[model samples]
Target: MPNIQFFALAESVCKKLNLPPIPFPVRKGRDEIIFNPQGVALDLLLDELEQYLIEKPEEKIFYKDAFSRLAAIEGIRLGEEGFHDHAAHYFELGLALDPANLALRSNYALSLQSAGRKEEAMRQYRFLLQQPVISGQCLVLIPAARLFLDCGDPVTAHQIVKHCASFMPVDNEFWDLFAEARQRCGIKRWMAPRQKQQEIMRQATAPDYKSAPTGKKKNFCPACGNRLKPGARFCGGCGHAL
Candidate 1:
């Protein structure tokens, strides 16, 4: 159980690290949970905690939980205050203790993006996307697609969403972003029927199907090689109506 001494120790640690005063949430009849601190460099603080844990090896689990939680809370606070670099630092501290914490990784990626570290942010997003737990969920994929869109790579964003959007459950947010990406990639609008959009995307992504050379005209639908009736507006084979 934490007490006044541990709280004082954490405050001193904060002072030593040149950070702002963190209000340690003291739970009644429980441990004094000291906030790791926001708005400061936490590398030193983490190092200190590590060294302390080394000396008192038996208390590792307790200290790790408390400190990692503290890091997340303070890191989020720092991010809210527009200190994105510091926030990222705190998130890294938390991740050191809980490497599999998706929340910390997500926040860390956002912090990196806000700090103008776009490449690092993309890397983090990719890592999240690769995790089995994400399972192509828009929670990570949409943000990653947005990053590509923001980077003037709408084609990539379109590519990311188009393939997955076909199979995933419909989400308004995902569709909205999908439409924005599609528009940037030269699609006229997102209000088109889902089937129509898929057809367009299929054509857009499909390999080039050349028409007859010279004066001759192709006699079939390029998408599925279905024989086309003259003046037909859609393909009967694969519904390749544009």
Candidate 2:
């Protein structure tokens, strides 16, 4: 999809990088803007767009836009380099300029989490949850829930997942997290009260044969749901560890 926000971001990035702007056909009526992605790849375009913005004497509105884009780009790069505090600084500046930028907000929240600023990250995630445009997005919802869980607020995480259930797909990872949240939050009502009581009675009365003793419970990778081998530190499928 051609995201208008990202299109403007690309233009702003080009300005900050002092690179020639992508050519667009000039429209006479209603200023219709068209973009073609056949020639240059988006990643390559963004790679060329990375730079720090320097203010000039005769700065215009475009300069501020470029500054915000540059800040966002640099913030992401710095965050990847493990300089999360510095990344957050740039993300804050970018968000101050364009408060409605969802991508920048997401990056800001991630930077805060990476910097061990848990409360700040949660605050940003709450703000994002209130935004209609971002609330239903998986990118925002998944991380927000994970952050809530990390903050020892599994109830909030479960609530977030419940609110987004209709729109979000039922993924194994989400279900795994939901199960953990429910367990941690002490939510035992998985069925009707009468049915739960009946099931409990059935289990109590059922004759059980002791099976062979099982060893330690198996662990699965949270990212990919692959069965973790004994003593393995990382997931074989996705490379993420528990």
Candidate 3:
């Protein structure tokens, strides 16, 4: 299974945040497997390549260039469209090329979580959070905390957000998760100032933030009118694709 390969490669390197095995493991006689560049446009690939190289300069010398990152993007797009298995396949293909790609690994975990493979998803999250790099990265940490909440372990989530909250910008995306974590820990007596601060942060950062009348939701859900979380790709209330 790719899961075993993923974890094995991760363990071999002692779980560094960015370094997976250089020239990732492949089946015998397939070391020469060339990545075919198709599906995504070349211009888009090049554009993303420039951004990726800037963000992850360590990957500049890797084989196949930006194709692996492209594959990761495609995988995420597929997952958002409800084709999860296909998404996993794309992520696996991307990881095979660039095993160190954090985006590929984290999105793979998310796809697994969306498919109801929570344990497998947590395995990936555990590997990710072990690295200090992930602690300050809102993209990975928030989702991992959300997964912890979904698994009914808000205490862990609260701990994660608590540490991150100290250093992360107050106006950023961590507050909602922080609030949810606090609520889950049965901390009902929130200070008014903190509540006001959370609301201010939400208004400042939320893409869909809006005020609505009584009996109406600020965010719409087809299956249920649960207020959507910022940056959520799916509805939390009914598991509906957003």
Write model 1 residue lDDT over 1-242, tens digit each, in one string. 34322333357665564434533323343231223335333434454555555566676656666567667776888899999999999898778777888878888998898899999998888788777776556566677788989988899788778866876646767777788998999988766356678898998999877876797676799898989888899997888983
Measured by TM-score, the strongest candidate is 2
Where does candidate 2 clash, by residue pair? none
Q: Lowest-lDDT window of 10 residues in candidate 3?
A: 1-10
RMSD of each: 17.6, 23.8, 25.6
1 against 3, candidate with superior TM-score:
1
The segments of candidate 1 whose C-alpha lies over 4 angstroms from its true place after superposition are 1-51, 54-62, 135-140, 152-156, 159-176, 183-189, 192-242
| Most lDDT-accurate candidate | 1
The order by descending lDDT is: 1, 2, 3
Could you estimate the TM-score for every candidate?
0.51, 0.53, 0.49
- Give one clash count per candidate, in the order shown: 0, 0, 0
lDDT of 3 by residue, 1-242 (tens): 23211112235332432333333323332222321233223223333444445566666666353457557666877898998877887777677667777778888888888788889889888888877777777767777888898799999898887777777546535677787789989987443346788899988887865566577346767688887887788998888998
Q: What's model 1's overall lDDT?
A: 0.72
Error of 3 at 240 (Å): 83
lDDT of 3 at 81: 91
Model 3 regions more than 4 Å off = 1-67, 167-176, 186-188, 192-242
CA lDDT of each prediction against the hidden true structure: 0.72, 0.68, 0.66
Worst 10 residues of 1 by lDDT: 25-34
